[model samples]
Target: MKLQKAPQAAPELVHLEALLGKASVTPLDAGCQPYLAERLEELGFIVERLPCQGVDNLIARRPGVPSLAFAGHTDVVPAGQHWQVPPFQLSELGGYLYGRGIADMKGGIAAFLVAVERALATGHELPGLMLLLTSDEEGEAEFGSRVMAQHLKTQGLLPPWVLVGEPTARSHSGDTLRVGRRGAVSGTLRLSGRAGHVAYLPPTANLLHRALALGQQLAALEWDSGAPDFPGTVLHVTGLEHGDWLDNVTPSSATLRFNLRYSHKTSKDAIDQRIRALVPGDLDFQLDWDRPCEPYFSLFGEAQPNFLTRVERAVFKGLGQFPVLSTAGGASDGRFFSALGCEVIELGLPNASIHQANERVEKGEYLRLIDIYQALLESL
Candidate 1:
């Protein structure tokens, strides 16, 4: 048999390979931002490193008006063992690029970088462009985008438009763009009762029983019919616990953990009040809520009101079809910038394998992402 040479990787793959090879997990940058800053600096951007609460953030901006911020994260979720290929090494197999954060975001970041390189090479005068890189998106997100956003707001340096490179596509790379996301609230619910023997249960009403009824009520109630731009509110019981297993004794207290992904039509206080009403008047119970990301929506029509029309047309020019404007996913860092009056939109590769073993992104889709981002830049 004749010997054959193996094909070389694409240039875009080369850039992504270097990024994936870095050991950045959760809140750790693992030196990825320095590498990106070098590239941005070469493009006439002034790079600034902002470290907050042990998390690394980079802001690269070119001097000009009408700034557009391109936001992304360098941090990735932990890559657990048991994968067909090394999770941290960029692997090309059957026309797909596999890595830890390829589908979720690193690939999106790489695409934007490639797009900027191409645009700058062509001598296209881009309006004020800012790259907001953070290392805290996959973690608590406390010292990440929010930190930069607040700092920029205080200095009156907040951009008028922001593009978050979060993986939002469902089936195709440009098939869907997230206009907004529902708000999330999570915490524990506690109920108290007296302890007693199972056989003699007069004074001890079972906290578990009352909690079960409350859980059922919350799950069954229909909060809203969902707005045209948002989804209906829903509550989920994540965990339930009581005293240790004792066949002869009744537990004194019970705790139930829950999360609610509510729409813009619903408020946290409203949901809290509604939950309060479900608990029995005689039961001694308390429900604590943790509000993380609030619900937000961007108006989309022709072009003037929101930037959705221009982005949609750009996506069509790149992918040969318009994308659906949706708000059906979990919250993202985009919400932080949106609160500052920036028109924010999320666009990236399909999210089929994010946060899973052997997370992969299609090679064709990866290339298309670059095209979509470049076209968006030109339009802006």
Candidate 2:
């Protein structure tokens, strides 16, 4: 079934479609930079560059009172082997549009630029609406919008309300407004033991076994039963290293790398305490509070009902369903925005194939997203 769009919405949408035609695959947003900057400048935005190594970030805005910011990335994960249509070339295959980043979020960058541009063209005061685009998101993200957010905050550049264009859609609902997200805490647990031949019966315990036990405990520990607007926190063990390449030699040490997507309820100190308590001594263990970031909650207790009310009404009218206020997922630049206490929410196209080849979004749904974004701009 096709999603419907009004005739008046066709023109600007064609522009979005054309931009997707230009492939902005990661590290090489190749032809995408000038096009975006030109479009924003054409719309009378004051655009600036946040220079990084090879890729660059963009900050664009139309001046207003209480500032507003929309953030998203231009980088697409490398395309794999799923091409009914060329991943770099945009095409309407079936009812969906096929292309890398169409959903994971070229769709967002396209819609907001057009909606905000249209709104500004209306000549009504918007109390300050802005948009920022970064190219380092799909990579290590060491130099993307997060860095921009920090820079903005230091210079008092943070805005009043911020929306991150992360695809937050599910089967039952068209979109969900992400009010909060669990904070990601990660660490390297190193255990040391005596190096010896496998046949040598040493009194020393196997550091590998100790590290494995520690990993099990850390993996089982619960971070939270979910925060006010988010889901139960999740802990995942990403790396386990031991048995040095020389298998027969009882390697002196083993390492485990793990991460916790913890809710705001559990602070880093508390989480660390629980971890260290589980270790058995003479095990020679090393722990790092490698929490480069902390989990954050929105101004989202019952205390901020009005804020959610405004967003729910907007989501209801915009997408025909009230957004489920949520805080589940990997960390995003939203974490940085939240630090400065911006009323943050993330919404975008259905994440059908965000970081993959032949990535695509339904043409119908893509068009509908513009209407949704337009509705949000109109309401806010």
Candidate 3:
């Protein structure tokens, strides 16, 4: 794509450019949160800097019970090699703004800020509003929104509705709004057996052979048929390892690393039980599990018509088309709010280039998002 300078700076673009100037790589706010805090404070918000284990977090709230909260992260993934423009500086090319975190998701943050400013400028009192920002979303995520959610719960400040600015749109801005996310569980399976020469080893003694057989069975196992809003539970064997380097020798042990993206229809305990049943009773094996998160939907029980209807109308008003409600993404911080019994929805710029080299968002789409968010705020 050819590089072209934008004609003029819009408020949201200017904000995004300043944010892109900050090299806030994972676990490092690099002054991004403080800059945002200053702007929010100017809007009559009480900004609190909550740092957890070196990760920067900010919770800015206007007086009153928080009815709507905008949640996002400032930290970005490492800007890898081979970019067409400097990753730390915003560049406009072919009507797209390129920079790290522009789509995942400093762009969303900037748009929301401008939207809030525009909304309040009308001299209309908005419902109780809050902003939750963290600089660790792209890192281990242990100290980001997870910790913020705890603090909110303690202070009794958790909002009834949360809008996470994760890049959920596909083809265009507001095309897809995520109502929920699938849970992710990772596992390591190690099978132990006797090592011997390939020609001399018994079939049962070759752990690699057993591992392959078990892997096939595991891959074929049906977890769940899926729900209307969520996809079916599926397993993917990510890696396989064996100690043997020589072709003639059978390794004594083998390890298989796998991950499962499960829907709410299947429980973690149920998944564990099924995996255990698939293993041969006579085999010596070890199965280890990592921290697993459960799937969550914005509509926990019955659907809340008011909240969903407002969002849909706002999206339609902004884009002239209603968005499709989906729960197909991997995971996001929105789950933190959903866990708190908050109705959470994720909507933002198109995600085609997020986290990739030359990450970018269409300049028009970025401006349009400001309108969408403003409309949503007004409707609420």
Q: Using TM-score, give the best candidate's number.
A: 3
lDDT by residue (tens digit), candidate 3, 117-205: 99899875675799999999887789999899989999998888889999999977888999988999999999887788978878766
What is the clash count for each candidate, in the order shown?
A: 0, 4, 0
- Residue 164 of model 3 has an lDDT of 92
Off by over 4 Å in 3: 1-9, 196-202, 245-250, 291-293, 300-305
Which residue pairs does candidate 3 place in steric collision?
none
lDDT of 2 by residue, 1-380 (tens): 34333233466566566666676667666667678888878877778788777777888777665466888888878777856666665566566677778777787888777777667667644556777788877777777777788877786767877878888876322467777777777877787777767677453555666677778887787556874456666778889898555766667889888877777777778877877787786677788857456665678436543455666666676667777766766777787778777878787777756676667677777766666776667666
Residues 12-57 of candidate 1: C-alpha lDDT, one tens digit per residue:
6666877888879989999899999998888899899999989999
Worst 10 residues of 3 by lDDT: 3-12
Clashing pairs in 2: 64-128, 65-127, 65-128, 183-295
Alpha-carbon lDDT, every model:
0.84, 0.72, 0.88
TM agreement with the true structure for every prediction = 0.89, 0.84, 0.91
* Candidate 3 TM-score to native: 0.91
Please tell me which model should have the higher lDDT, number 2 or number 3: 3
